[model samples]
Target: MKDKQAKWCPELGDFAGPKYRAIVAAMQRDIQSGALPPGTRLPTQRDLAWSLQVNLSTVTEAFREATRLRLITGEVGRGTYVLPGNDAVQLYAIDKGGNHDTIDLSTIVPARAFSSEDLRQSFATLLARDNLSDIMDYPTPDLMQRCRSAIGQFYQPRGFHPRQSDMFPCAGAQAALFAALQWIAKPDLPVLVEELTFPGMKIAARQMGLRLVPVAMDEKGILPADLDRAARASGARTLVISPILQNPTGATMDADRRAAIVALAEKLDLLVIEEDVYGGFTKEPPLSLQLAGRSILVGGLSKLVAPGPRFGFVIPMLEGNEARLPEQNFAIDELVHVTSWMAAPIMLELCCHWIESGEINRHMEWQRQEARTRQSLVRRKLGLPPLGRKPAAPHLWIGAGQDSPFAGLSGDQAAAKARAAGVEIVPASTFCAGRMLSDGIRLCATSPRDRADVTEACKRLRKAWS
Candidate 1:
């Protein structure tokens, strides 16, 4: 059999000696060099061990290492296979990477340490009472009051003087947006937004059958004049904005821009829906554009707090509108409300403790420093120009160069390249409601867990671009 064989597999022979790391390196090289295409079935443990003349235990360990690196996936009653698309695999690995793992610039959360121990203890205390019956009995005025107080305290310094009656609790930001769209805008009406904006809004508008109108913007933000023209042309009655720390772009509206937008909205009699998912991360309180009193501010704990909290509060600028707001406006009714409301008390208590202890502010400051540091690294190491001169909020936007790898490609294509390069980026196309296109990509620096990881990821991105 040995005399008749053509040759031993180079990978098996190259991965010689006792250590399993050689096997991992050999497999990685093969994958990177395209010797093994995606979806290629890997050798079975026993077969690979026999072929390599190694113990089955060595093969098992090697397979585990590959899985850890996200180079291979296994199935029950089936063998492992290479994951489809290098970019997809890279994103999956980066998303699942633990705290001690390398930095991933693709995620959108601050890197500050969060302590949920106190909150967990509070939850346990509440659970000990076992008063589940009362908590489950639908939201009452008392519960509303508690929720309002908790949410109000956070907004008070930000110029949002909200009353208990003005507040409404919902499942999360998406639900609040859905309800707001349904309540405020008529079907088929154009909803104005930044040319580059949040993807969630685009998804929600499409699902609700609302037409989106993208307005032109400058360094400050959406041009007030452009907004006016679009509103007039489309008969748009509502404007959706992220005045502070605008997603994908990370451009905060300066005081002048805010006043100009508010002025335009007042002139047009437009209702504003302010999505404040990144609200809590700002150093100073954001100036609310809810000045028209026709605006609705959507705040949530997902970004500042853990994503699974599933808690959000909506504060309507217009008084007496809550009574007129449709019950369907509270989108949580579709899903079992118990899941969100049951955890409400605990969330409320945590918010209280975080605010009182000043931990929230301290954390925000630390995150700001981290974000600034990462942004600087991206500019210097990635050889990319700054998107703007303002203080970036956890994200940096880079315009693709003419000779850039992402040039001439559509936003999705650029995103694919980024994924393949082992980094995740938000394409600028999703932000544009119309046919407008931008040669920009948004890089998130907040979720990488540490500075070194961010630097390494940036280096990979620079190499990919080159």
Candidate 2:
């Protein structure tokens, strides 16, 4: 037993003097002396008890003390391991007196409270379906039909009566967006986007060899006057806008702005691509592509539902505008795999069940209420204005002033600081196109379950700002 203990630290001290403090001091000495390197797994509680000739409970207490010191991190089913040094030591250190668990504010996702047991049951039911073996087979029309039916049912309440022929399921909204861009915009042609927009659209445009033109935006969204000027000045005939919950800014287009933009698109002969990823969350989103005359509406289940669903519906413009799309589009060709599409029926059925049972609406209402409360707390704590409207989406946009402490830091710097403080955030630059610098950052308020987490996260953010 003494030999096994010596493997950790050959020079055994008088650990029997005071069980708790002695064990803690020994572990600290080993760490300082580099006997326990970063990422090194610590001995099991049982083994340590046997080696130290202490009871299992004493070993457990020692291990708990070490964990409190942030000398190690433990994952369930995985043994404890040492943590790396850095400011993360202060932020992640167990003795730091704050939550070390990461608060992911980067991705805009629905709150966990919004998820229902019915959804899980639906997934299980889908997995138990007859001919489940066939789902592993390659893509086929039967799979497409099933997915389309499920998708169509999902959007029926949104007044979109899409047929199986019209619906095309992709990996997610990102894939659908790429396909739409390829089909609509000519290579090297300037495509118009909101001054602040989804970062993925910019990346996709660059990869597709399309130039992105940032149209100016007002309180409502992309200003129609600026859209006209950009369209005429740049001769750009393609426009991509997130009519609902515009990324980074959280500005949704109202009726007047929507009508004006639609009119401009018609006059400019532009192909309008409305990416309404959060359409399901809203009571009534803007007019669908079918109403826009010559537009493409991209809807997905990733936002309102679980992202793992990987199901999206692309409703092309009315019959006559099919020629406007590219002849050989990969989005139109590479249909969703049978297995991926199989997940659709389960999601749709779950959504339907939740909707009928009033659980979905209730859950959404609770999320909206909780989100608003959290957003209000963030506003009060950070001394920032409100970023979300009454519906209260998952994320909020924070404007950091030039003289602000965070102003000197870059986006990555801000993210690193926030992460070091155990709160993750997406910088404003993540949403901008070109080399434009933004004086803001997007904060996602979806994770915190109580006001305490929100307050602590805000306090950490204030420190990061300083």
Candidate 3:
């Protein structure tokens, strides 16, 4: 018998996927069509199960998924109701028109280190070069060699030293990560990652049909015991780690922490993908996991330099072991060829020029000073502690402290509050890989071009919370 009070029953015919997903689709459609308006009490799981002739578990799963999508809310005693603002499907939407009024602390980007004239001059120099036509063509081996040489010089002091044959040019860190995933882990295989990790890694994993197993992390980075447990439980053979200035959360692994992780990885025979894109910000970072034979390092220029150039490197730091290069190189090469053909020659050359001419160094030095200033300003505004290492990280993690306005609120709720105040922030939910919900949001200090904007954003954020 059906429960008389259960009013909304979706027609799941139009959706072609799994039954639960179809139910969600039907619900979304009905909500949008105004057939099921906001505050309309949804059918009880059992009643819906009975009406739709699907299992109770199916309806339960559908409800869970709907809740995750923020389509509906469930009261303690009452049934589920459509969320008031269900029209906005995406939580994080990029406004391309670039609203000046809205202070965006969401994306981590370096502030302007060079003027427009400087950029125009660089392009002019490129155009005037006799080899301009060569750069326009597909990337040649010699071009990659020159880039590798330049990368070696820039990254040598930062604890990265790779043989010329061990390096591959990538369009950006994302591409490098994707290529690394493809090369190391097979599709559908479990890859261990930080519980709260880079959002791009989540996207790339989903795109490539790879399963991500979340490992527990602390203020210092991933816990070795948790990593061991997660790896053993999931039988994951690969791990993607950011040892220095982890994304979303500014968790940098110390020397002892790194050693523990490396030892655990060795024991488990796990292939570690170490991402050190933000490593340059630290004056002296801990030794990279790449120095260990089992690790592959992915480094790039996007964070320290401008995001426009799009140049990154994939190097297998095997410690003088070329035995594994042939197979690994083939896998990476084929993956890159299939996806992007090759890194854009012009972009690579531009970055290489910046590196060789010491312009990139100058840009980094300026970025460091700018980041420290912005960080100090934001911290002061929010009454937060100093974050990261000496040079200062571009981003900082904000948790719901006892006195904070975000207190007693989840990361997403806090972010929503900040967004309401005309400041944008990335919630912890955006970075989560597993079911565990994180408590705080990420604030990128260098996201706003001007220091005053960062200050204003923090002021608004604090006031809104207060």
Task: Give a tens-digit lDDT track for model 3, residues 359-433.
Answer: 888889888888888888888888877654544789888865576556777666788888888898877757766
As for candidate 2, its clashing pairs are 70-94
* Descending-lDDT candidate ranking: 3, 2, 1
Minimum summed lDDT over a 10-residue window in model 3 is located at 83-92
Can you give the TM-score per candidate against the true fold? 0.68, 0.67, 0.80
Query: Per-residue lDDT of 1-466 in model 2, one digit per residue for the tens?
Result: 0011224522346555657567777877776776764546667778877777778887788777775555554444446665432221121222322445766666676666644666676567657778666645654566656566766666666676655676676666877787677665566667788866776676676567666666777657898998888778777777888877777787777888878887877778777788888766676644554344567777675666556656665665645655553343444444343223434444444444454555555665666676778778888888775544555667787656565447777554777799888887776545654323244677778755557877888899888768
- Candidate with maximal lDDT: 3
Selected candidate, larger lDDT, 1 vs 3: 3
Question: Cα miss at 381, model 1 (Å)?
Answer: 2.3
Candidate 1 residues lying further than 4 Å off, grouped into runs, are 1-104, 115-137, 283-290, 320-353, 356-359, 384-389, 402-413
lDDT of 1 by residue, 1-466 (tens): 0011112233655556655778888878876776764546677888878887888998899888776565665544445665322232233345454443334565566665665775576466556765545554666656556666767776665666676666777776767776667665555566788877676776676566565676777667788888988778777777888877787776677778888888887788777788888766664454443464667778776666556655676666765444433233344232224223434554554454555556556666666677777788777777666545566577777665575445566455676666676666765544544433344677777777677777888777666655
Predicted structure with the largest TM-score when compared to the true one: 3
| Candidate 2, lDDT over the whole model | 0.64
Clashes of 3: 0
Residue runs of model 3 more than 4 Å from their true location after superposition: 1-93, 96-98, 285-291, 318-340, 388-391, 403-405
